[model samples]
Target: MLQTDSMWRCVCALVLTFPAYSTAVSGVLNSPTNVQLTSTNMDLVLKWDPPAGAPRDLVYTTELILRKPLMDSKPGCVNTSALQCDLTHLVVSIYGRYTGRVKAQLGAQSSAWASSDDFLLDKQTSIGPPNVSLYSNGAKLEVSITDPVFVHSSLREIYYYATYNITYWKKDRMKELKHISGLQQNRVVLHSLDPSTEYCVQVQIIASTAQKPSTPSIVHCARTPSEKEPPWVAVVVALFILAGVLTLVVFVVRHWRSLSHFLCPKYAIPEHFKESLLAPPKSSLYLVMQTSQPVEEFSDQISVVMCSRTEEDGSKKPAEEKR
Candidate 1:
């Protein structure tokens, strides 16, 4: 067992380091390793790892094998230095089986052809989600889908005909989702939607006669426009606003004096009115007026009487005695 293992390791090393020289015993160089043929939406690609000891500058040639007709990797993939080749045009039908063979060549020497495993397009091909765009029209939403771009071939060349499965729902009512299937048109309109509502939609492509459908597109959301307003409603609102502003301007020009009186009054506050808001009540004041009492009257106590005569001693005698 150890001897077998050592021999295998030596063979691997030789293949990795060997140039494109055919061996004397086999008359052929080592073949490529890990050859694989893959399909992306029916776009065929052939890839492989170089021989273990293969040198650089060794060109490769690839061939496509079908049931009856054999095809060469086109677009000058022959003698190509690239490790991969595009054989998309060689795929005639999705239901057909395909295989790829590649050989390394350097001048007069060549390697044994390395063949890939059988490839079934319908079973092995990978499909991608469609591109989605949304347009809003009041109470309706319009969806537009674009097919995913393939590496070599177009979507129509493979599928011939395709349909879409659209799923949508109101953002608020997520549990109540709706689906529309088998829609043939690339552009579709969803009507009867609630006005001014946000709705989300996702779409998936179903290739005709294909067993698998493309992945669902990313979620897209758009809000519908509000319900249509009467054409004259805006005009009426504008006229009313204009009239109110004009009326205000006219009133300001006419009664500006009255407004100024309140805005900048000329009258001073009376002493009573100047009292503090925090002052005590009238009964708590130093002097309180009684509404029921009559006002008191006062007179001069001294009377001035004309002197009838003067006393000889120059003293003003009593006017009554003189009289």
Candidate 2:
């Protein structure tokens, strides 16, 4: 009876220690409670820690499982002693939120999986930079671009802005050419410029997360011409006045010479007739008078004179005093 009782006591002690052994086993597989994922060329990685408070004799195994949400009832698992596991079988599809889980394993028992954080993947190829153009129209500079026909998003919102830099006569410079969002078209016009000045303009585009600008567009140049003067200009008017004055001076000098000739004439008469013409006429039918005084006394004077002579034929001589 004593031997039997001692055996029963030993069995009871062993049964009591079983719970402690299970608790220790739980601790070994509970180390890693948090899960993280990273991606590379063609693989996704699952990262976690070792079991919690485990003794050196306790061995742990990490298991990572991935699946398409709501589609795969059973998640594919990676069984390994390493803290990180590569996801080579996971496929990337249309962009969306993905679900995954990481679990801890010890011997034949496994702990509930620690849920993983959500991840987003963009697998579409970029459409590259849109085409750009810089040109000049009369006094204005024009900037133009082609809408991105091929891009990552079909309904993607697009925005655009541009800046122009000019270097003239050896000086550094910059100008904000444009800042436009959701334009209906790609063309813009700039006006108001100093005439005869040289200018340069730069153009850029935005689509999806705004593409990198084009290699600074080639330089474009234009020079405005000076306006023309009116017809029959002021200069011609000044010349006409100068010519009219010169013609008037020539006419006056020519008329002065002619008037002087008419006022005073000089002539010499024949010597014989000169005396007869100078002699006073004989008075008969008229009277003759000569005054060596001022003409003020002649206001009431009326002068009359006659010339008479006898010819060889006894007739009143025909008076002939020729000069």
Candidate 3:
């Protein structure tokens, strides 16, 4: 019975060992999928999606393949946990064609490398958009555009020359657009614009090495300044006003007495008129006596007569008479 128990235990051990060995020999990992290469402002990047059923702890490795005679892949992003890698520094030739590849790794097991589509460095790389600033000069508008930022190379270093494309229009008149293409100046002046009017503008770069023109900058708006009067005109007007004030002051100094006399008088009243107004009123006795009837006058002279007694009939009787 003890011999039979030992054989059964050996059989159970064999079964467990066989399954583990089979998994080790036959199991295969899935490679990374959907690899892509892209660049913006000369900054190249490699991106990929994790393999199906990939573990959360799986690491990744990346390589850059340059298409040429006897060329080999350059290894980077080795044993990395991130899904993306920056290969901006690995680009040796600005005009060369390139490709990117990546693989998923977990301990001793690793998937095959998945490749990306071919990328042309000179024609496929993207450039940054332009930046715009506006200023309102008197009777004109000034637009200023700046060069796009570069990652590993400058505009002059790659293309040797660059230009700008400007589009402008009156405010609220978007359909009537005006374009100024292939401008070489950063500070562009728009002349012959309407005065005291608002205008909107956008700018783009014409890079020779870029696949197309750089993205257009944000729209900027400003109003043209109004026309101003000349400085000499104001001076002339002020001089005229000062001259008139001086003339008026001189005239007043010369005719001050005449003006005062016309405005006020100093005549005096007679003394008789004052007495007549202030005297007390008299009675009307003289006026009534003078208004009586006139009496008759005698022509011959008469002698005086002395009498001691008068007649009784109201008649005078003379006692002695003298002629």
Candidate 4:
């Protein structure tokens, strides 16, 4: 009877070691994995390994609990079958230390919580490289840089870092190269550079804390135009153009008067002379005769008469001989 009891106990132990439904439920709540916070929008991302030990009849579900200064309040939670969650909408203040955790749930049972090593939530990353823009101001190459927005209000100032390659070359020969570095405001003013040389330039940025310098910007090149003028050259050019326009306007006004006289004859004539000129009578004729001859010899010759009569009256008048 004792031997039979021992055999039954052995059978029970074997049954507990490997349940029929246990194969479907298997996971472990590993340590908190990826932990990072974005500076701009205060977005938080947390990840972890899959959890272990779920009830044989239930599927394992993962939950994320994020809290500032450890698990103080009911941690903002999310339930998913995946291993990670983004906690972007958490309204935690950016003042104190922050900690996050993950837990696995299966039916009424939950695995151990895995928490992240505490880190300050209010930390701000260093600024990025300033956006460099290139331009020119008469015979000089100019650079303009715009600063990045600061996440931490403590950042008060930004400094520019720059380098350049300037060269003068001929057929199969090159000479006069230079590299320069300095700290200044957002604008770099280069003076007395070689006028006819080709130059390539790059710019970088550094913050007040003196972090690792940002990656240098792409190289830009400009050959200084020949040194022929000063800043006042633009004003001189404008004045010259204005003088030329004024002279042309005066010439145009004088020429326009002559053109008007030639095109319109009525108003173009002198008013005093026009009043003395008589209007001609319509359909009339005038005649004049001057001669030195014997009066009797020309007595029978027909003569033209100056008449101011209508055509009907002239046609009815008969011819009469002079005595």
Candidate lDDT scores, in order, read 0.82, 0.51, 0.85, 0.53
Candidate 2 per-residue lDDT, tens place, 226-284, comes to 44455778789878998998888887688877766776666778988988888878765
In the range 195-261, model 3's lDDT, one tens digit per residue, is 7889999998888767787878999999987777789999999999999999999998899999878
Better of 1 and 4 by TM-score: 1
Total colliding residue pairs, candidate 1: 5
> After superposition on all CA atoms, how large is the RMSD of candidate 1?
25.8
Give per-residue CA lDDT, model 1, range 111-156, as digits (tens): 8889899877765687788999999965799999999987645777
Candidate 1 local lDDT, residue 241: 100
In the order shown, the candidates' Cα RMSDs to the true structure are: 25.8, 35.1, 32.2, 20.6
Worst 10 residues of 3 by lDDT: 19-28
- Taking all chains together, each candidate's TM-score versus the true structure is 0.50, 0.30, 0.63, 0.44
Cand. 4 TM to true fold: 0.44
Best by lDDT: 3
Model 1 alpha-carbon drift over 4 Å, by segment: 1-29, 68-76, 89-96, 106-109, 120-131, 146-161, 169-178, 191-200, 215-220, 226-323
Return the lDDT, model 4, position 300: 61
Pairs that collide in candidate 2 are 31-51, 31-52, 287-304
Query: What TM-score does candidate 3 reach?
Result: 0.63
Candidate 2 Cα deviation (angstroms), residue 230? 45
